[model samples]
Target: MDVLIVGGGLVGASLAIALERLDLRVGLLEATPPGALPAVFDERNLSFAEATVNALTALGVMQKLRAPTGAIARIHISRRGDFGRGLLEASRYGRDEFGRVVVARDFGEALEARLADATRLVRHRPMRFLGFAESGDDVRAVRVADADGERVLHARLVVAADGTRSAVRDALGIGVEEHDYEQTLFVTRVRGSRPPDGTAYERLTDHGPTALLPRGDRHYGLIHAVARDQADAVASLDEAAFLARAQETFGWRAGRFLSCGPRSTHPAIRVVARQAIAPRAVLVGNAAQTIHPIGAQGFNLGLRDALTLAELIADARTIDAGADCGSDTLLQRYAARRREDRERTIGFSDGLARLTANDAPLLRPLRSLGLFAVDRVASAQSFLVGGAMGYRGDVPALCREVRA
Candidate 1:
């Protein structure tokens, strides 16, 4: 195989689909079986950037989605007890919407359906990656186990999309810089007294940030953040109580949250791989970096990582069919290409998470001024919209514009 992707989750599956048109052999190894539910695909609501929507649509994944997705026509950002606030309207930027909201489970199902039709992709499921070895200068010996037995698969390059606690990354001896936000995030669906008008609200508090993302089916997806110490109490709250508490924290911005669905909680943390590549292997998605969800940049950034890598690999193949896909030269180029976008995104997410959570009196003025600038300045608004739309660094061709 020219490339073997470990972890058939979102990023890995996306990479496989993106490379289907390329003249190269690709294999996807996933632990989950064909009919089993993937752990990464749950009831979480994901905010897809415009670029992500375009890329996925081009890959035919979006068209396969059976569930309806909501459009984010506007974004309202504010801090609790603060006078300054920022609003970004898609029309102001000459766009229909900033992005669309998707259910993670729905997205996974679409990816699965799309992968089933990929002619150039090979799948190995109900399989777990054991480790890998540098078998030859241009090949890697990867060990995987299934119900049958363990076997080795050789490939010129390996891509790790296994996630935050990636076994592939660990086996490659890559270290991560981690930060515990000391906050717990609760997500669920909620209906407000007022119907959604394509507006998404992000309410920042001293403890953490809370978001009400517009979702299809005329409901809003709620993301409630609280300190770790209070997580237990929040989790134990009944539906009515939870809705009441959420309303209190978020104020009446989108009208009172009338009803809410089941709640799910996740501990917030930031993880960044010290390096993105090592020899014949490379890391993508959460395996490369996991940032706070404040800006909803995690998956969007990961998709870009996968697309950029795919672009480079396709280019290499176009130039020389006999090229070593995992050559040091190729891996180094991938790292250099990803550095600017990766660092900028991580810094934005991490900095925003920490800045808004700090209650220092000095920070209040600074934060207010910053908000004021972003709201009042056209250039600031353009920059904000550009980032929100996933325009950074070297954008992939598929993500550069909507497909004709």
Candidate 2:
């Protein structure tokens, strides 16, 4: 096989699909069976950046979604006690929306549907990746197990998309830099008295942030953050109590939170792999970096990792049919190209998570000033908009194009 992907979740599946146009054979290993859903594809609502939606649409993944997606036409940012606020309208940039929102489960289904049509793609389902059996100069042998038993699969390149605690990464002897923010994020769907008008609200406070994203069904995706110690108490709250607490944290901006769906909690942590490549293997998505969810940049950033790697592989093969896809030069190029975007995005989300959580008296003035500048300054808004739309450094070909 030219390439073997170790995780058939969101990013892994995307990478496989992105390479479908190339004349190389590809394989995907999924631990879950054909009908079982992986934990990664849960009830979480994902905010797909403009570039991400465009790339997915180009790859024919978005067209297969069986559900509707909500558009983010406007963004509102503010602090709890600050009188100043920052607002951005997509129309100001001559676009109808900055991005779209979709449920993670639905997006996973769309990926599966698209993968079904990949003529050159092979799938190994209910398969478990044991470890690397042998690492040769041009190819690597990976040990995998299934109902039939254990066997070795050789591929010129191995891409790890298992997740944050990736076993594949561990076997590759890669170390990760981890930071626990000591915060818990609770996510669910809610109905506000005032229906969503395409505006997404992000209210930051001392504890954490309260975010409300518009949904397609006249509802909103709510994300409430609190100190880790209070997670149990928050999760145990009744529906009425939860709605009341959500309203209190978010204020009356979106009117009262009348109803809410099931609540889910996640720890706010940042994980970054020390390196993106090892021998003939590479890491993408959460395996490369699992960042805070403050800006909803996790999956979008991961998708970019997938698309960029796919683009590089395609270019290399085009230049030479027998080009070594797992060559040291190719891996170095991938690492060099991905560094800027990875660092900036991880820093952006980590900085926000820490900055907003810090209630230091002196920093309050600085925070207020920063918000003021972003609100009043054109350049500041442009920078924010650019990052929000996923136009950061070394973009892939598919993400560079936008259509109405």
Residues 342-372 of candidate 1 have per-residue lDDT tens digits of 9999999999999999998888888898899
TM for candidate 2 is 0.98
How does residue 1 of candidate 1 score in lDDT?
Answer: 97
Query: TM-scores, in order shown?
Result: 0.98, 0.98
Tens digit per residue, CA lDDT, model 2, 1-404: 99999999999999999998899889999999998767778778899999999999999999999988889999999999866889999999999999998888889999989998998999999999999985668898999999999999999999999999999999999999999989899989999899999999999988888999998878999999988999999889999999998898899988888899888899988999999999999999999999988888999999999998898888998899889888889999999999999999999999988998898888888888888988889999998999999999888889877754
What lDDT does each candidate get?
0.92, 0.91
Global lDDT for candidate 2? 0.91
Off by over 4 Å in 2: none
